[model samples]
Target: MTNYDFVIELFIRVDDAMKNMPKHSQAKLYPSELVTLGLLYAIKGVGERAFFRWADRDLRPLFPGLPERTRFFRLLATHQDWTERFLAEPTVLGIIDSYGIELLHPVREREKTLVREREKTLVREREKTLAPRIATKGKSNYRWIMGAKYGFLLNQLGLIVDWASSWIGTRPRKAITIPSSNP
Candidate 1:
């Protein structure tokens, strides 16, 4: 189907879903308009700035009420749940999978030279700011690495049913103890 056709279909579906839901407080853009832009964002898979630029140039005619970049993003975030419900398909069986997303190279974590200095500096800065909440040392494939793990649940049709990511849990250190000769 053409892009305009897809946008129209998506807008209609989301608009129908929104009919049963409460209206947004003081929203200038309709839910249909927001969902259309959201579908465009997902299909384009481009960065926010690029998406905004393209939309302004090409999509303004179709979505004349499209807001500024930041405002558009805010609207998306505010209605994220509605968007998810609108996009998700019905499924009976789902396959779950997970993978580690390494933030730093395992070898680089041990390196103490200028070659690794920049990465180290960045990690240090991130730790100071986002620490255990976002990044942590965790095991992946029996190897310790600094990173986060992402999990996904997919339906038989290979569509994602759900997804999440979080800081990896740190492994517990083995305690050292001396043998007691008296015992």
Candidate 2:
């Protein structure tokens, strides 16, 4: 009900889940403590400075061994991988969708199309190296998009199971399989 109660409960859950994670004796905060703080920061949806101030003022009682502001944040960042323990496993059913984002107009793409139409070989190796290759021509319902597209796979409970992104018209391997709960 209260923030303190919620934080304590969250810490308990995180600690129970992370029982296998080895903790360093020299570490100021336990792995669970750091994870609890990180989870709080994510759930609060506030800037680091504000979260630090709030924790220092309100949460100090809960986490008496709280480190200084910088070290506290650095610890969370360093051990971020620990949070993966909370990721929901892929279920038997899921939803998949994609969204296309436009970064630049298809000027270069159109130019290349026109050149190829004339049966002319392109010799713009230098231009190719200088272009932004991260985004490619992808299509959307509105029109052709000259950018990138991202796809999300969500389980029945709406938790993200997997995701992929690629150029338009190109498909990524669906390697994320939903195994039955038995195995």
Candidate 3:
């Protein structure tokens, strides 16, 4: 099964766990749907704007019944108490390795001119605001200096149980960690 399929299953499991929990009735998106969509966005390594742009065409199949991005993000932000349970779970032996998911502009693409420009603008803005002040020198063969890092905390099974992004620095700052676990 694709990673999205597994994540869909994970969301169902989390929803089942929260079945008896107290929640507001006015909430537009379910906790499971919010987590699922966020994971999907992270997995696709695209921003919400991009996701929404292609949601009808590309992501609808994966989501089946996806909600609007505003609703999805609102649920995620306003209902953290419910979602935090997922991130705190460790699906593995106690440690999960993290990686960076740097979204780069395609070196050979002419379509989606507006999207590319917006992504580039955002990246440049992030570079200005988020890049590390201190610089370290290294001369390895793959001497890379990523300005920021973004990736999921997946188990050995390749399931994303968490997601994090960090600024590149001697003392890297932790990014927001998304919940990706069970109760």
As for lDDT, the candidate ahead, 1 or 2, is 2
lDDT of 1 by residue, 1-183 (tens): 986687778778778777766546887677777877887798899999999998899878878878889999998988876665643453666677778888887677556346446688776776687644545667877888778777766767987666666767743232212223362
Candidate 3, residues 1-183, lDDT tens digits: the string is 965577668678867766766544965455566666665666678877787776657656666656677766666567555555665444544344544432332332334446657799776776686545423332222434434455566655565566665543333355544444566
Q: TM-score winner between 2 and 3, please give it.
A: 2
C-alpha-based local distance difference test score of model 3: 0.56
Q: Say which candidate scores most in lDDT.
A: 2
Model 1 accuracy (lDDT, Cα): 0.72
Give the Å error, residue 37, model 2. Answer: 0.8
Count clashing pairs, candidate 1.
Answer: 0
> What ranges in model 2 sit over 4 Å off?
98-151, 163-183
What RMSD does model 2 have?
A: 8.2
Please report, in order, the local distance difference test score of every candidate based on alpha carbons: 0.72, 0.80, 0.56
Which structure among the candidates has the greatest TM-score? 1
All candidates: TM-score: 0.65, 0.61, 0.45
Residue 14 of model 3 has an lDDT of 69
